[model samples]
Target: MPQQYGTGMSHTYSTTSSSQPPMGTGTGKKHDGYPTYRPIGTGGTVGTIPNSMTESSKPVYKPTVTYAQTSRATVEPKSSSSPGQMYSKTRSGPSSKPTHTGDCKTPGGLPGLSKTQQILLSDTRADAINNVLTKNEHFKFSFGNKRTGGPGKGGEVVPANRKTFPALTGTGLGMAVVFLGPCGFNTPHVHPRAAELGIVTEGTIVSSMIPENGVNVHNADGTAPREILNTLHQYDATIFFQGAVHSQFNPGCGNATFVAALSAEDFGTGQVAQELFGARNNAAVADVFGDAIDGADVDKLRGAISNNVALGVEQCLKRCNINKRK
Candidate 1:
């Protein structure tokens, strides 16, 4: 006999029958000594394993950590000590008076004077010197004094008769004065580094200065030179600029005097005048003659004046339309 279980059915057989030959050979059997089979669509029954038999029976989750926001504190720098404290520490101590020494620490120190004494001494010395020089007549004469007058028309010049100072000696800076005698005329001349200041002392006089070219009066054919340009004239109380080629003639019939103050002690003729005149003459003669002046003609009339003088005079006279005098 065999027992069978399936779908709420149970059977027990005690004897074998021919119709069911053997259990293994039975047909249309639902169970074969194992669990019964059920298709998913049939909905007869469903089965599953217990929770204890599966590996994921209990789940695990790890804990996470979060950080809090924070800010860093700022630091301040230390302060320095006060100026008074620093100075006192460096100097060692505080004293009311400064130490004094008989000899001054600076170069050229007041040899015999303290600070106050030195000031007093210097003032006294200056005052004494000024008094002595101002009171002395000789000192007054040595230096120049001022004068006044009026300027004349047509470039008339007044002469100034000044006492001649001692000629400058040695090579250093030198100063001198010249007095133009009444109705005295100072010939045209140039000075180097000596600016002249003229002061009128008496009657009205006319002063005239001519450019080097302005004096050209000769022609290429050996005629007398004529005035090439207008003259520069100044009246009394007027100062003339120096360093230019110029001449002054006293037109006053009466005695007239003026004082001329010059930069240099000695008055010397300058080369600019000589060159300007020489060049002017040469150029004028050459242009008219169609060639350079020969030595014979140059010596006979032109004299030994520089070539520059000839050129300058020629140019000036030609431009001014001045005719050569016979």
Candidate 2:
């Protein structure tokens, strides 16, 4: 006899005497030595094994497993008064936000974390929204020093990353704080990876940009084929797309400051004015700009721009009709 275990029931097969002889034998005599087998039920029965197969050649019956049984094998057994009784099982999952249940670990479940990692791992949507009052990176890290090259130019940048401002972890963003003294300028520069959105917090500035598409492809007047220029004042905002050559100048007598947010954490800079005009010698500068610009003009421009003082402030002030200090 053999037994088979199915999803919800069991099946059995056994040898029994047959009144009729085997299929080819015409003699209608009972055969009990090698008995034939039949399923007990007409409906809802497992398929019978073929009679042609020898008893030794047939595959053995095996039990079919149910979902509940499979689940129980791996899961910890629940204790109860009766062994047959089961309690509902549950498993803990990763947190919806960064959280530590008194134990420091990343969302990735690694331990032995740094203070910066710990803070970042505890961030949540609710906590991030309240950053203006708590752990505000700009106010805490950048606002106080107020370093400047001169009256017209200096900028403090918060390159928010896991290392710099851990609270911004998982958020791909950063900021630049530009402060211009009356008649100060932030020289022509490009953020290779970031597009910038800036708001003027005080005074006025002339914002200018030559798009990357127009860098080598320029008009005959030595300007980019396409350019953007705007006069921004207190509370005025502007956007400079990624990889564009741009500059800002304070045209007002009063000091100016603007806060800019960048699209990426590591926004790199290339200052075009310094690289092109502030070279140590004339030959390098002329080679950089090519034969289109005269060698004499390159030297002349280099002398004018090499100073720590910003070059465009006086011209900006004059055009805006703001006085340039004598």
Q: What is the TM-score of each candidate against the true structure?
A: 0.27, 0.45
Window of ten residues with lowest summed lDDT in model 2: 12-21
Give the residue spans of candidate 1 off by over 4 A. 1-138, 142-183, 211-235, 264-326
Candidate 1 per-residue C-alpha lDDT over 122-190 given as tens digits, one digit per residue, 9 for 90 to 100? 335443234222244423333334322212111222222122321122222333333333323343456
Which residue runs of candidate 2 sit more than 4 Å off their true CA positions? Answer: 1-142, 145-162, 214-224, 273-312, 316-326
Best by TM-score: 2
CA RMSD per model (angstroms):
39.4, 14.6
Q: TM-score of predicted model 1?
A: 0.27
lDDT (C-alpha) at residue 125 in model 2: 49
lDDT (tens digit, per residue) of candidate 2 on 185-239: 5656788888999999888777877676635544666653455778888899999
Q: What's the lDDT for candidate 1?
A: 0.35
Overall local distance difference test of candidate 2: 0.51
